[model samples]
Target: MIRAATDTGTFVPRIPLGEWVDTAVDWVTATFDPLFDGVKAVFETLYDGLDWALATPPFAVVALVLAALALWVKGWKLGLGTLVGFVVIAGVDQWANAMDTLALVLLATLVALVLGIPLGIWAARDDRVSRVLRPILDFMQTMPAFVYLIPTVVIFLTGPVPGLVATVAFAIAPGVRLTELGIRQVDAEVVEASRAFGATDSRVLRQIQLPLALPTIMAGINQVILLSLSMVVVAGLVGAPGLGAEVVASFQRIDVALGAEAGLSVVLLAIYLDRVSSALAERAPVARALAAAR
Candidate 1:
């Protein structure tokens, strides 16, 4: 005496959510190990290259150049501050590890911009995507940072790569969300004017909206980099190196002075990166124009 379908078929009950998820993960791991291996290999190659490049004397040379660039783009004060931060990190016997952390952070931030900016543009152009993305960004922003480390560990495995993966995941939402908001907030009249002038969708997006929205997108990038830096210690739990790992080790042993040093290093690094990113974002439109002129 059960409810009957139109056809003579029996219905099966759906699996519980917990069991379904576990089973799906198991299936994916079993079936997609090769795909995962390929991805890991690619990341390893990139990070390994970074490791070699940054572990050399040229890293210090590059730091000096970056300090000069900062002076030109921002101001003498920011340049001096950045130089001081680098010097402090280098002097504290943490140069290699600090560089490793910097490499991972810079790489992750670049990846986020590469992927997130397009998604943001898509969301901005379409009302439906914006509606869907807004809630998701809210979740990414509102969720506790520690909780992000768990799933990241399971997927990427425990190490610097996993930490980088988690840091990117944690930081990416803002860039996407802000980019969407910035583009959408562009003057409707200007967009209409572009359309009236026979601009294609791509032309309007590239020449009109994005140029106008560049500052906002730059702000988003700045925020993303800052957020990635904030997650460094949490990332260290999964084997991310540098001051974060030191912080973790010091805290484990209750070594107050060591922890303080690690913490200060992180703060200094954050300030340096933050200022540089902000300046770059602010300067992008002019730079783009100059590039176009060339």
Candidate 2:
């Protein structure tokens, strides 16, 4: 008997896309063991230093110092807010976990910025590079955050190291995209005039493009930081210690008070960092060159 053409059986064979990905991951891990170890060491050192700095101090003292930093950056109101926020977090007995989360977030943001800014600059200079990066960035941002943990966990096992690597990958896209946007948004006429007046590409970028782009760049930095905070908290699922641990514990044990306390502490830290970053964006100098050109 002849099979009907309307038969529902799929004609195409199933593609083993997952198996191919697994092979690639296995090969990379085997080949890059030494490189990953060196990277882990560096990240651990930076994390340890931040952890000690924040954790070793009396809660009051660390709070005051951060408040002072806020005062310097934004003014008295934010400084006061920072102080009170930390005190409340400490009151909830979530201070240590909060500090751990902060360190991870800060380190991840720093690394993202360092890598992103230059890449952004390059993309701004070259249309080809920008075109090439668009889809890659779209994939990075659109992929589920949890999927990032899979390769990292496979390669590095569970812990802050894997978490850190995953968090960095998750949080880096905005910095690159924004930096490119900010640089491209710089007034082209101003750039041309500077070039006409004997300014080199480097000089025009340093003195004109970057300064005028400061506000936008700062906005990008703010995003990088906020994303880092959220990702770091998620990282706690892999045995990374922080308020995330506390938050996760609340879910597992069905503890209301613990959830409220940990959740509030995360919110407090997020707001403080956000406020500082937003304030810094507003503070970016209005370049004299752009003003004179206008």
Candidate 3:
């Protein structure tokens, strides 16, 4: 018996998605070389400043500062854990690398917050803006992390700067989304009441909407930091120096011990940051309530 057309092999398209993407990237790189350079310079300045601050301090001093911060944010147990974790990283000779990773993560997070929060505010305030940004945010969040590095490398070349740029791009979506969500979730009655009290649009946003939405925004920041940390190892592949670089080097040389140590350092940093940020987010609601009470 003859097989039906439904049993035929799947059809293949002649379109070359890879080639199309490469061409688009090339065009953008050529068109915006100076813009990319300026971005690279800004990123480098921030990264260098943070790295210097972290690296110049005596190891013990740096560890103490981090422990203090943890204590301030999370309480004594996390503070002690952070102190011990940093000491262990230093003992394993990974202190510098860990600091480098921390610098990169923080820098990326700052950039993401700077850009994301504003976009989120815009999106939340305007229906058109929200509709336009939803798909873009979806794309940013769903795309593979490695895909972000491609255009970044083309525009900025391989280095910590490019890695950071890509990281901000990859990690910023949540910030925008959460901020928009938070602002939108603000009570309509509260916003109207503020406006009825002769508050201008900006005043209403600043005093009522943003204040109420702050907790959600803080959660967004927490997510951005976590996502930035997740990109550390992948970013290392493009010459981002830090624990990521160490992890990559270990893999290249088949040194399991080194990889494990570096990996553990990353884990420790992640835990510290996650806990502190989470605690801060938890505090936002209390802070808002106190402000309202006043």
Candidate 4:
């Protein structure tokens, strides 16, 4: 008797995910054109204002201001380093590009925080919401940064607007995750004590939970900033002008010196941002008090 053969081939779905996505995107673009246009205008206005302020000032003046900020936040050593780094960037004629990058990063980080913190707070307070958001946050975090640019360009048409939108989306996951974690990590006993003391839910959250969670929240903000900065190159590809554009140009032309200089400028900016944010996180009053008590 002949033995029966079993089917060993893997089954493939007939779903057209790509076409569905395209259709959805087309629907959104058609329906929300005005909203997207408004967003573009607002972002452009903010970017232009920041770029003008940084570029209009004499190089020495802007450098001094940044150095002073570094000194105030981090210390004398970092201040000096910041001053020298900016001077070097200016000397290499990359000051404008650096400033543009800074503007974009700042705007993107702001947008991420605005959207992330509230969502995080909600997630922390509700298990249902948290469960719903977990997969979405995971997808945002795991998706390649370049993947964001496609939909962004389709909707916003390749400019700093799309760049800012993509940067915010790419950078927002850490902000949301850390915010939720921070709030949830607040000591239960402390929370109960506040409740026992006649604290309202809002009061308990505002006075006790948020204060304790400040350091973690700050860390989230720092992560957002770093992620936004990391998107500079991808953003540049879509017409966002910055040091990233210079880096891309250098690559296309194979100008090693230009690439090195642009890369160095980005490094300097990263160092400055990282140090400043770290210092800020450390200096959160609750964080400082906790450290002292420990």
lDDT of each: 0.82, 0.88, 0.90, 0.91
In TM-score terms, candidate 2 sits at 0.93
What TM value does model 4 have?
0.95
Measured against the true structure, the TM-scores of the candidates, in listed sequence, are: 0.87, 0.93, 0.93, 0.95
How high is the lDDT of residue 246 in model 3? 93
Candidate structures ordered by lDDT, highest first:
4, 3, 2, 1
Question: What residue runs in model 3 are displaced by over 4 Å at the alpha carbon?
Answer: 1-10, 285-294
Provide the clash count, candidate 4. 0
lDDT for each residue of candidate 3 in 1-294, tens digit (9 for 90 to 100)? 233355567554456778898999899888988988888888888899999999999999999988998898878998999999898899889999999999999999998999999999999999999999999988888999999888887788888998998889999999999999999999899888888889999998887889888888999999999999988668998999999999999999999999999999899889989999987876776465766889
Query: How would you encode candidate 2's per-residue C-alpha lDDT over 22-91 as one tens digit per residue?
Result: 9999999999989988987888888999999999999888899999989988999999999999999999
Model 1 misplacement above 4 A:
1-21, 58-60, 286-294
Candidate 4 wrong stretches, greater than 4 Å? 1-13
CA lDDT, candidate 1, residue 66:
68
Q: Looking at candidate 3, what is the lDDT of residue 168?
A: 92
Weakest 10 consecutive residues of candidate 3 by summed lDDT: 1-10
lDDT of 1 at 79: 83
